[model samples]
Target: MKLKELAHSRTGDKGNISNVSLIVYHLEDYERLRQAVTAERVKNHFKDIVKGEVIRYELPKMGAMNFVMQEALGGGVTRSLSLDRHGKSLSSYLLEMEISLES
Candidate 1:
């Protein structure tokens, strides 16, 4: 499945490092997301494309998650070429991700 299909919210540029925030509407879904998308797994998924580190942040208060991907664009901001046309596509991508709630 595509990364977008697994994320509740996602955002980033093509050539520059970016961060993708995800919000699991249901607690059950959050558990599934947590198990399905791991830092190592995510890194591996984008290993060929990204060149930096992939970090994950958990927010229990908001029941949300955040991913900070460094150098994923192949280069730093100075040399990266990735661009977000509307700056909102990332959220849409995240919403496309599908996961089952933990039982």
Candidate 2:
């Protein structure tokens, strides 16, 4: 299954960093999301765009997680020439990642 099936995402950016949040639709799915969506995996998933570290914050109480990706915006929004300078579409890209939901 795709990550999108389990959660929706939001994104924010500052300088060259993009912060993405994954909020699960239900609390019961949070643990599965945590186990499968590792920082390493996410870094690789956005390897072409993100050039720095991917740090993940666990927010179990909120059934959500936040990922901070550095060196992601081609320098910064105001300076970047990329079509999506603010990286608004990055959350959609992240949600495209495939995950296994095995019992």
| Top candidate when judged by lDDT against the true structure | 2
Model 1 agreement with the true structure over 21-58: per-residue lDDT tens digits? 87766655566677777777666655655567889999
User: Which candidate leads in TM-score?
Assistant: 2
Q: In candidate 1, residue 57 scores what lDDT? A: 93
- Candidate 1 lDDT (Cα, 0 to 1): 0.62
**lDDT of every predicted structure (CA atoms):** 0.62, 0.96
lDDT of 2 at 85: 99
Candidate 2 lDDT trough over 10 residues, lowest sum: 94-103
Enumerate residue pairs that collide in model 2. none
TM-score of each: 0.63, 0.97
Candidate 2 residue 70 Cα shift, in angstroms, is 0.4
- Cα RMSD to the true fold for all candidates: 4.3, 0.8
